[model samples]
Target: MGSLLFLAFAYLAVGQAAVNRNGAQTAADAAALAAAQDKRDQLAGKWVEEVLDPTQWQDIFDGFAPGLTPSCWRADQLASQNDAHVDGCVPGPLEFEVSVEMDNPVGDSIIPGTEGRYSTESAIAVIEPRCTFELPEEDAGDDVLPQLTCKDRNWDLDPEDLGDLPAPEDLFDVHLAD
Candidate 1:
């Protein structure tokens, strides 16, 4: 009876540990996906490929869990020693790993959400800039602080776009509309 009880307790303890490790790994994985998606979303007007770089996504990984290692699927931070991808993938389904490990985007994390039984499923993506426009910088007198001009930052007006040059009265109307 004593041996059976001891064996049962040992089994239960081992199972508990497995549960904790799995839970932590799940957390890391989910956070990685979230970070990747957010990183890509933020690069709407910048280089999509560079923004998706694993190294650049470190801060997002760190935010998932405070101390998860690269070995852990949901790392506290990145675990790219030499293998750089910003996507913290490793062996085991808990983390991102590939047979060749050439920075393949795979893996999932289970993070609980409010009023939900299923975990959040998210994937990283790159957002391309829909348009590109620039505004001329206003001349600033030599002052320590930058000047604050309330004028509109966008002044992309094509001379040809205006079929007929506006009169002085029309110019005032255009300025007032802006």
Candidate 2:
């Protein structure tokens, strides 16, 4: 009877540790995706601003110096929402890496060292752009004829038609990498 009781307690402790680890992993994934989405929003805003300026279109099309947005703020906010805190937040070109630790430890005291220890996990997320600008080589007496191509569809750069452009969310895709 004593041996059976000890075996059951061991199984319960292992199960509790697994649950705590899964919660930490979930928080890390959410934080990373939130950060990447923030970067996508920043890129879409810059694209719109540059599209309006005909002179800036060439630079953007050539993939010149692109603007960057700090996304660690959103990562922290998201981790907190998931009952965790981000231990580290790193921003890349269009991605973010976030590590989070659970607010509370695995409370089942069946395990010795794990009673006061919290679980931690990390994840990476990326944002991909879906549009590019193209210009025709035809010289037409200095008339501006900039073109915006997106997913094999070409759209005219009419100032009035700017309203017809895709929404910022549609302009970029954000997802967790791991």
Identify the leading candidate in terms of lDDT. Answer: 2
Give lDDT for model 2.
Answer: 0.77
Q: Model 1: which residue pairs collide? A: 28-74, 29-74, 30-109, 54-85, 54-86, 55-86, 68-76, 89-96, 90-96
lDDT tens digits, residue span 1-23, model 2: 99999999999998998999999
lDDT of candidates 1 onward, in order: 0.30, 0.77
List where candidate 2 sits over 4 angstroms from the true fold: 54-69, 138-146, 152-154
Candidate 1: tens digits of C-alpha lDDT, residues 89-168: 33221223211121222222222231122222212221122222222244532221221122223223332342332222
Candidate 2 lDDT score at position 47 = 70
lDDT of 1 at 107: 29
| TM-scores of the candidates in the order shown | 0.29, 0.83
Query: What is the Cα-based lDDT of residue 148 in candidate 2?
Result: 64
